[model samples]
Target: MRKSTASPAKRINFKPSVAKVIRERVDGKCSVPRCKNAIRGPAAKGTGSINLGVASHIYSAALGGPRGQGGMDNAFIASAENGLWCCQIHGSAIDKNAGEGYPPEQLFAWKALAEARASKLITDTPSPLGWVDAIQLLRFPHATTLPRLELSRCTLVAGVTASGQTSLLDLAGAVTQSAYAQRFIQREPSTSRVPFVEGRLTYATVDALDRSVDVQVLGDDIHRILEGKPCLLPPGDIQVIYTTLNDLQARPHEDDVAFLLRLLGVDRSALKAIANAIDLRLAPGPLRFRDGVEEDDHGVSHPRRTPSGERYVEAFCEIRTDELPAEVTLNGLSTSQQRGVILALLIAKAQQISQERLTLLIVEDLIVNFDSSKFMQLLAVLGEMPFQVLVAVPPARHNELLEECAGVATLKPNPDLSSWRLRWLGAPIQDSSPSVRRSGVQGSRAPIAKLL
Candidate 1:
């Protein structure tokens, strides 16, 4: 079977301020020459009048919209310069002829004339609206082709083990962080467009700020942040926390109480809550993590050792709660217990961060040790936090999660699991249907490209 490979086109959203500017410039009238009719009038019931003017794009606002955006910079394609306010009749008329009846140059001329006239009638310009915050789209380059995945408030991704679910989270985190840094922090050119790693890795993205950037350019830098190392991030940049088997394990060097106190802060009440949430016994004593190799009452050491030919020693970071005689290692904890503790800690950390920041929590192999009841508890706890979460469960539990998730993406793995077909919540992996005819195609003409 031939592999499916195609990259999705980048989707851009026009800033609200840009649209407001265009409408105000025309004094809320249609921008057609000698047809500048007032498009706003008093509503039948409401005190404020209704607005009938449409904020139309000079070039296509979307890749698949009428007049199809042709090789234009994604940044300017949705800016103020590309906008025109026209009444319903003329607006529909202009976009109807497959973009042949009225070209971009003609629309620009109309906009100029309308705004020039408005300058005489109006004294002060209207204040603009700020951009709204949200994750609108994600574009991925698969081999030589590019495909995109649209995002909702919350997205759930499910697949069999090793289906690249965690990798997707990594990609999203990296791309978003890079763009955030470039647009908000650094005034000069950012490394967001530079290639950081090799292979088939290259991706670009657009954010709420209408900032477009190639996120994969900061690939390695993003990886470092994931590893818990220090990297410069813009204020309010996304905080990403990922947990695999290794992360679930308790380290021998980490004192449970001390670690919690440091990571969760020195708040005494918070420490008690963390301990209770993880079902750890709270004993009154000094806070310290004991070595797993320490002999118990039976005089036998419980430290885990590596299977090296000649060397056998404590090679894992395993910790024991002060109140428990037995050691508590990530490997020894029940699947549900491990998930509970990890999630609790991460959510707490996210809450402690600035409200302006965003958090992403990713869990792979989610259902390994969870039953239906435990999984539901996990979901309930997650719903309470503001952090964005990506959980990967096996196919057996896929349908169940779909019912409760905001959006879902399913993966159909290849024989070797090296590649997989992705299907959005209710759509097929590939769009095999014929393209539907777009509205407003009167006549065909050479596609016009313009930059804002």
Candidate 2:
């Protein structure tokens, strides 16, 4: 005798609005945690939307459908409460094998999980611009270690060449880029020698959605870390501006200047402020900064040597007054004057962007060429901006810069020649040696013995 098969039960249709409500609850993402694919997109050629998702039923719509649980009343069968929004693939898979793979309990759990994620995303949207509260280092490259760094209005990172000051700042930027730091640690735990075994990075939200983002990185891969969640900074909400040695030229590259201005969102008011600051600083000097152009030309243009054998660009911005020539060339300016002009430009650029996003201005020894007074002026201007500032400088200027800063950290080479040790300068100091607790906790701790 042949095995008997039950005939297909009467098919129940879903109300038009029921599918919309179910999709809205899950933010139009597939309900399955591992397969949160976007199922709807703009129509191929028409104005109407196209939906590739299926509002699958946790309890089947028909008596013979997956997990249909025969003999239930038909009215409640196709209601919104029974729907699970998922991509067509997962939806079809669930309905096959008589729902053996995905039972009613499992499908309902996915629905709940998807709704929770959607709720968090909707409620926790970041403000237009938020401040960077702090940068916590759960892990870093090499042997030296650091504690949770509390940021302030201004921070001075003092270190000798190759002492890892720039590396720390780079790591901070990486972590802010969509959980890359977390993924790095998850892949290479042996590279980090820090106390926090479960690498975590926490940042606060300004609109008070949550106090911080507590990200656990260890013992889990990138996929597990996400677990159907989003990044803390979202996309393009935070900007990290890094001015390296290449950007600190006396006469900055035209392309670099234009890029900086665009990032800084410069305007006439900002240019005026920069000019005023430079003019005030250069008092008693013959030269005064009035205004500068966006660049020498519409796009990238090289400097030309004049008949007098002076390298000049076509007034790429200006540094002129009534007594001075109509056009000023960068080659004609003195070192101090050029430094002043560059610092002013940078400050003006930084101030303009702070209002639009959580901006971080990272300057690597840009003021190393400045005199004490000019350096102080640059620090003052940077501190006034609404963004966090990280300045990396050599140890010689540590005393000059630390007095006015909110916090300071020093990176010094170790005697053993293995790695650079990092020390936080909690207070202004007369002697750098006194601030480093060599014989304290750092001395007693051994190198990383194992990877978790």
Candidate 3:
């Protein structure tokens, strides 16, 4: 009898286009969770590019290979759907020990997450709308028009209690028509003078031409002017979020943890990342549903109604943090600590929610209660964020705040009964005189800035 020879298993390889598509789908980043290393960049010579990514097979192309073929069709096994983009390191690591470390389910999850993140980046990245380079008061209280205050990426406005620190922040919010602007701005009772705030928004056009738009807010009216002409429609890409220290403080009848979770889009992973970034630990308790239903005498279920005859349902998870004792609620933390948590949560929410719009974050009283080191750490974080940050600090902390800020705007009440004097410090001024010198006073620091 002749010896029988068995046929070798067919091996299917990914086509070039299929591999390219797999890599492009994830924006050329590794499809490993928390290992999204950029795989392509300029080479050493600068004439060509270097690629450190691999289009790895989810299931091996041949039998007896890592993540064996498992009898999958040759066409499907070689398609882009079966491929995962990964850095060279992860590509090898995943296949070690016959792919025992990483299961197919885990790889699929990573691929889905990576693709979702890439899609979000494409959708959320907005066009550039420029920055607020200068602002001038139009008809604010106690002043008609002040000097055109120049703004930097990180501008510090420092003043005493009644010296217009909050007023300046309010003007910024009003100019941008932030959601909380109306509530924060003090309305003039007499209505004799309409308050107005105007700011210069400078941005580059598609042709690389430098252009500026003047955004004016007069009382209840808001408009944009370009090239000395009023634009019929204002640009809709700008977004502003304003929060005061008081806003960060816990409110009666409001659950801080629940509100924070909602603000973060109920994404516990994101909340955990934020907690880690802020040096805090988070342990979310089991979810609870309450006040949604009730049992009657007949054992029949019925919807629960409030005293006002409105049915309501509530579900929440108790978020425990290291800031307070395990037994104590979030309110048990100090006022400053509570404010810090709220501010950090807001920052995280802003980062997750909006990436395409021109965002301006106006914050008040951020430097209160934090020691110098902690305050500096917060400043460093703010500086690294992808946005313009404007902080309002007391005149006394100007020196410390100035170290991290691009420039400082000192608001001082005039010696006489006149308008406030705006002095620019740490920034070069054409005219350097004693009249524009800095001042000294102890107060709180608040951050007001923009983000991309």
Candidate 4:
């Protein structure tokens, strides 16, 4: 009863059209409907890359597939429509389940059923309120060049926790490290909220960008709302929009002032002007806190200081950057005010501000004690130029001032980035230092080795 177990040479999939749509839709993830996870080669887990995702046939070759198993023929491409992309583990499990001895339908049904159940849990049914679970990342040895294995979608899990709670990710379609991050940003709850809606997307409104936006939802705008909040951000359900993909080259932490300013289209000379605005003398304190909306003959308004002592100032007008000091604090100004100042300084640096370049500014944590009206005035200037403003904060107060200050952009914890999955680490090296604690550590101190 010996059956041939031959190796199939790798096949090339040449469907750029389907791949293109898939790239834009899922942005480099497994194409299974609603599957937003990426695909990583097996090298991420010490496995060879050849053992990665399978462009599996939704229909088997034995069931009239053009080619039998173990063939390099493109006929078995199965087409993107009929293709199922999955990581090596799931791919192997799929092959194992379809063996003559197993009930392929039963095993496959569990995954489908789980996805449908998750969808239903959000709409038709309710998950138990008391059931709580925590999920963490999985680590691997660092010596190997594994691509970073992970579940493609949060809707299903690739791994589980110690308590036996099944992960909600489809571990079957683990993806590469970089692609995983992109997919998460594009489709996670932050970008798409409604579980039932397939093609629905969320974006901010014009008034949300400017203070003029009527507070139809919460009886005020970003400026008014942030004025009352403790965290200086709006309440629930706020989000940010990434209209452009500028500066993806910068590391998340190393994103510098120059990069942000460049994106704003600031001119070199104007940038110098704003950079020179840091004044420590005339307004030795934060930009003099100005209460009234009045501007001098030239349009520059003085600073404002509230009764409780927070500082605020107006940035709605342009001024000579060369005359501005190096450090001027604008009292009573909201977070939107701060962000707007930085953004405008950059934008003014540009010789030409393109209409297409304008985007809403989303702010988090503006629902605190910021003055909503002043915030609105600032947003009004930006909005007149047809830009947006979004803000986010914790589930607390300061809404009145904050709502008027900035748009809303809620942050979602990314599974791949936040997972903290361990990677290979060489054995720890022993330290040569004696157990004794040294005095004047790192500064005005003697070298311990010399003392020894």
In order of listing, the candidates' clash counts read: 18, 3, 10, 118
Cα-based lDDT at residue 151, candidate 2: 51
For all predicted structures, in order, the TM-scores are: 0.40, 0.41, 0.45, 0.23
Q: Candidate 4 residues 1-452, lDDT tens each?
A: 12324235443453756444323332233423223344654565565763334444433434333323333234534344334444445445445544433233432333343334344344323121110011122211121211222211111111111111111111110110111122212222332222111111121121121111111111111111221222233222222122122222433332233333444435445544654543322112232222334467898875443343444222222233566634333333344455444444432321132232322232222222235444334334433332222222212222221221132211223332221111111121112322211122111211112111
**Where is model 1 more than 4 Å wrong at Cα?**
1-147, 159-164, 173-208, 211-236, 249-332, 399-452
TM-score: which is higher, 1 or 3?
3
Candidates' C-alpha lDDT: 0.45, 0.51, 0.54, 0.28
TM-score of model 1 vs. true structure: 0.40
Off by over 4 Å in 2: 1-130, 159-163, 173-202, 209-234, 248-326, 331-339, 399-452
Q: Give the per-residue lDDT digits (tens) of candidate 1, residues 1-452.
A: 12213223655656878889888887787877557467888998969788888888887766666676655666567677778898998888888867777777777777775665566235322111111112212323232222233322233444322222333444444443342222112234345754332112121111112222223334333322312233355223454445444333445554444344544444656655544434221121122233435467999876533333222222122345566555455345565665556555555555454144545555544345666666555555554555555454534455443332234343333232222122232222223321211111111111121100
Ranking by lDDT: 3, 2, 1, 4
Clashing pairs in 3: 126-356, 365-446, 366-445, 387-451, 388-450, 389-449, 390-448, 390-449, 392-446, 396-441
- Flag regions of model 4 displaced more than 4 Å: 1-51, 59-80, 94-238, 241-305, 308-324, 331-452
How many collisions between residues are there in candidate 3?
A: 10
- Ranking the candidates on TM-score from highest down gives 3, 2, 1, 4
Clash list (residue pairs), candidate 2: 292-317, 292-318, 293-317
Candidate 3: RMSD to truth: 19.2
Which residue ranges in model 3 land beyond 4 Å of their true spot? 1-130, 159-164, 175-235, 249-253, 257-328, 399-452
Taking the tens digit of each residue's C-alpha lDDT, what string does model 3 give over 221-290?
A: 5556665677765445444456654445433444444445543344656665664444231123323334
